[model samples]
Target chain A: MRGGDAGFDEFVRERYDQLLRYAIMLTGRRWDAEEIVQEALLRCLRRWRRVPADNAVAYVRKAIYHEFLRVARRKPQVPLDELAEQLDLEDFAPAVVARDHVLVVLQQLPPRQRAAVLARVVLDLSEAQTAVELDCSVGTVKSLTSRGMARIRQLWAAEQAAAPGRRGT
Target chain B: MIAEEQEYATRLREELADVAVRASAGQVDTVLRQVHRRRRDRRNQRIQVFTAMAVVALAVAGAFAVTTAGEHAEPARQVDATTPMAQWPARGELAADKDLVARAEQAWHSYRQPPRGPLKPLFAGVSPNMSANMVVVALIAPESGQVAFVTTPIRVNRPSDPRDRLLVRAVAPVTPEQRGVGFMASRPLPEDEPPIDQNAVGMALTSPAAENGKVYTSTIDSQSEPSWPTTVVGALWPQYEMGAGAWNSELRVQFRGAASTEDYTLVTGVSDDVDLGPVALRRAGAALRAEGPGVRQGDLIITPNGVVGVVAAPDGTVDTRLSELAAHGTVGVAISRVPGRVREVGDHAEFTATGPGDFGEEQRLVLQAWDEPRLALTFAKLAGYEPHWLVARTAGPDAAENVLRLGKPGAAKP
Candidate 1:
């Protein structure tokens, strides 16, 4: 295969899903998130020849993250409930439903803590990788992840206490 | 509780796995198409830039060839200061299209004058040989010494001929000092009116030669009229008798009084030509007949030249011609929020005025509705600014008839 075609097909097959999932996590809104993903992918295609083959996925993921942040910043502040409404659960499994609930709870944390939690839990990246991705120290990333988990636990415990009969469910 | 945290992490991993990474069908294609279009546009732009550079290079080379071939080219040709170089080509010819003239004219018309009388003629009747769509007129008040320049966008239906459809695009105000000399009016003060003070106002006239030479004295107290028919002492005052035949002349008058310590001057061009005198009056009359008596004072009569003739009436009836001139002189349109007490929900506040001179001329009208927070909020997010939702449902003949959505930052009703 020619260099450009080989690069393009490989990028689509390898990184398309991961970028879309990241975009969905960032924007909450399905259609807008999809659009952000598409834009980032196109930008990647334009600079495909220049990107190192080994770090192509990382580069595209960063592009998606940046585009998501840009759109979020430009948009007016939406209520947390309105953001939740933008999420779709048609194909959600029990695990997916739990994850969605956790995402809602996680949003209450500050932006840095939320990023740390998403990187560690959702992305399953190492603490050092999360720190590098977030442009913070590993120690800071560890502390933020710890605090984020604690906050989520406290919120869930309060909810369970408020509803005694539905504890198992 | 620790097990639940582990479960949450597992669920997040499952959800991330379930998340689809691929774009919707054709989305990639669409994006690629957009990229291709942008690349094509960039390529076209580059070709155009290269072509322009090549043409310029060729022209320079040809000029050099001509100069080198001719021994007579040794003596550098001297050009008159007023007349631009013909062989070298005038920048005005290249830049002076219908749009440029229209833009210049619009700018001249939209120029904001200090709270004072009409603007003087900047220049009228471009050289017949020059085919231009744009014309800029600048007027400076001799008394206040405030200068106003307007550039208008114009569309010339007849580019080959000097006279044709001269549609003005937009009028904007420019700095006064930048306007050429002889564009501003200067006048001597009358002794009886008041002593000339440093604060006295001066004016310059530009258009309508009939009103050009006449100088008007501004009085601080509306009740106090200037003592005219006194001896014209100042050397600035040239002796010229008003001919029985209709003549177009510019007059500059300066006044000083207790109410206004500064010299206040008014410059206007008067045309003894009867034909032009009543065009504005006749138009205003027609507007009154059609629109009924909504026409009041403080409205503007915008001319094709984009000159704003304001309607000043302390009384209901605008009977006096001099009052008309003083009120409607070339000046800035004043836009202010309607008194909130007078404004109510669902009710649009309207202001109207008659033309200054003839009934045939077009009158001015402006309507503003109270802005609703909800509507403004929705549009503000989309537009990036709170836009003033004012609609010009109806305008006189010369006014632009489009529904303009003015952004709040630099909102002007005119």
Candidate 2:
């Protein structure tokens, strides 16, 4: 194996699950999340030799976010077909009681809102860092997270009202 | 409300932490396979382009020998190409050398996009053979509704090499002034067009030596809309499927005195060193011409995707003013046959301009500026609208200048 290939392969194996979970949080669908992570890793591989060893995980993480945003920007029809399969099979399964309520609720928000909320709440990025990651103004980040949090809260409340016996925090 | 929001935020993070989704088994191998496939595809594409260029170079060599062999030799009835060189008097330092001009014309016809067009040879000039014999031809492609200038390297007595052929120096929609200039030539601008005698500026055909390496940057006072500047730069066409980045889809042209090889394409085309962004050129829409009092007089570009707009600013900045005018109410495609109407784009529509900052030369700066079509696609994707690639025509010259107004399901034409 080429010197870089060994490192890249090892890196992918070690970080794949962590990256997949982060992608799922952003995309709200396992299929879309996998696609996003795969594309991001492929792009990262192109510059793998240059990525700082200590920061490779962060680099791949940022790449995943950017890839998700790019896919969202394209709004391509091909993925919506894949999305249909994901929705039918996994997202709305009878095991909704087992899935995280927040993950279920995140599907209702727009891509930017979800990204903003994830950056602020889950990744624990400050408003400025979120702005830089999302490529928007800090004020825009603030607005997106605020609106996103509100929607998630509303959805969580409605879901609790609908299925009082389901999982809730 | 604030306390509740913070509580929700905290719980959300906690829930996310509990969420776990693993990659499908052997997913790493799948991605590696895809990576290899993409690399193979890119290599194959480059080989195809190289093969085509090699064919063009070989063709140019044979044509040069045939043209120089006999002056009176009836120009072999040309097939599926621009106008034959026999029609125009060769007018440069190499004017005495008919063979050079003829070879340049042949090379240009070989390299031009949408090759079959009724041609009007505007100017032909040759610089004394440098590292390679350089020849430039400016002409009109009526079938495609564009005026273009192409540069090709001719190897007079050497073996054909694909690297020698430099194609598409400049091709843009013929502006009103060029239309008038073109009309002055034997072929008048197509009869259906309105008369533009007032805008026609007489053409000046200069020697290639005079223009060699001289850069002319047109200055626009930041305060006002520039009057017809010397060089007519327009965002020609965006080739989306060609590659991943907006760079592939976008071609910026300075079709006048600004013609030089120092543009973005020259830099990006030759070198694979510069990494590109993942943004794709999604769509090239129908031709939308903005004309009326106050409309920035420019060319009517006909791209494979569609006739987008006349990017007439000398700086090659798209006049968003036309769209901003339509934002108030009126919206429709200007071309009568293409049926579409947009009521209000509201917050969903916007024309975002990205500039390549401080690139020194205006041409480089111009080429890097994102044009309307790419903007339309980007905006459509970001706004979550199904991007219908059509630019709105300014309803009347009365709408505000420099704003973009697009329709929701349709595009805005004023």
Candidate 3:
């Protein structure tokens, strides 16, 4: 289908959520991730005719990734402080706390390392496939994942110890 | 270590397994509307480009005729010291792009001004790379002596002509003293030194041995570049990668206020822009509101749950604070019950904190204080047998006064 064709809307409707989740991983902010997804969808919609029918998701995902990188490049100021919302430690279950802690640790990784870890562990892609996605060498993928995993382990341990009741428990 | 890493990976996978976000009700309609607007903008830009080319052609032809008649051709336009900056003619490589100028003007009008009235285009630069083509526009309101810089990513629809997508990233206010000069640094260079002279547009060189360490800051007087307008914008292009020897380095430009020549410094990092990922902090909706003007670095706002650090914006205004912080900012607050004590031991200090279960006596943390007020916790290790190490402890002070004292030996409690 051409740009703005009937099939285009259907494709977007079906894959919007998946695209958003991936963007969230890339951007970290829901507002930014949503904006990125919308921007990517528009870009893909414009060139729908060229996108491969067999791999429409991959094409759109690539567009989202590039858009995130583009937005990142344009923003070249000092790093802002991330404000952690007040949370009652006693209010949550152990599972909820564990999930939240891991997610928090993921944010501490650099973009390339985050991407590598997500591809390898989350998506379960082979090293070669991960390299193809990241557009880097397989060796670079290995390096990124290794460094990423190491950082995550260190961060997870620190956060666990820091959490009030979790340490003694 | 391997088993712990695997455990963390397993948890990460489980945490993100069901991550999903539903598209908003009008997402499709919004995108379609944007697509139509983009098409219309491209058509209008083409017309504007043609009209500009014709006008330029006529001016050049007219100037040639005057020169041929044995008379000196008059300068197209001249500005005297008496003329206000807003009335000054637009000048820059991208000043000729009428569509961009119009978009910049529109953004400038809509953005929150800093006591400055109307601003006119001063200078612009387009930094094109494989990833994105970014155009940075500097607009100045001379009477108020304040300048605002707008950066937008342009999409080149056609190979020959570049069109403005008009998705203005941010319009940031630059003090008159800063003259709107900024730097865009690329990733660190490789170990093998490449020739800089061939591909360099501008260069900022600082030695590792310099008192400032990795971060190198310098002020270039706008008065020196008389022909280059008060605001000079330059980029350390992507192709000429800066040496990685200065790990996590920053390039700061000192702006001597245009009106009174007072020194004003802006600190910007030369690294990847970090975004707030989905976490309890962001999910619970921890929003940033400027406490007040002139919130200094390391200033903490104590809350019921934890501490919030105030990031210093170049100007004290809330608008500029949010705008600049949107790019790259760091705010880390750690409140731990584990008491950690640090005492100086020669050049480096040793920290003793409570250790966990199987770990022996005390967790010894060897810390180094960088020139900056920030304490660089070198590493934390278990003292006795089978020593396990924790590297790069970047958390904000848990033991506030002690941590501060570790970095600054004679510092009083905050």
How closely does chain A match the true chain A in each prediction, as TM-score? 0.74, 0.75, 0.77
Tens-digit lDDT string for candidate 1 (B1-414):
267677656654555555444443333443444443334334444654665577678778887674543341223344222221112111111122434444444444443423244334232222111111223333334444444433222222222322333222111222332211221111111211211111111222222111112322211101122221111111111111111011112233232222321121212211111111112333465332112133334433322112223344433222322123222222111111111111111433222222211100112211111231100100000111112222121223343311111122212333
lDDT (tens digit, per residue) of candidate 2 on B1-414: 288888998888776776654443344554554554444345444654665577578678878674654463333343211223223333332234444445545655776354455665545444221212234455656566655554453332232232244444434444322212110111112211221211111122322122222111111101112122122111011111111121222222232365433222111221122222211111224323343223323322212112233344432223333343223222222111111222235533332222111101011001111232212121111122234332233222222221221222122323
- List the candidates ranked by DockQ, beginning with the highest: 2, 3, 1
What value does the lDDT take at residue B406 in candidate 1?
A: 14
Model 2 DockQ (Cα-based): 0.17
Candidate 1 residue-pair clash tally:
86
Report, in order, each candidate's fnat. Answer: 0.24, 0.41, 0.36
> Residue B9 in model 2: shift from native, Å?
2.3
What TM-score against the true fold does each predicted structure earn?
Answer: 0.35, 0.37, 0.36
Q: Which of the two, 1 or 2, has more lDDT?
A: 2
Model 2 CA lDDT for position A115: 88
Q: Tens digit of lDDT per residue, candidate 3, span A51-149?
A: 878788878887887787788767552232351221112121111132334445566777788878987898788999888778899999999999999
| Evaluation by TM-score, superior candidate among 1 and 2 | 2
What is the i-RMS of every prediction?
A: 17.3, 13.4, 13.1
Q: Candidate 3: global Cα-lDDT?
A: 0.43
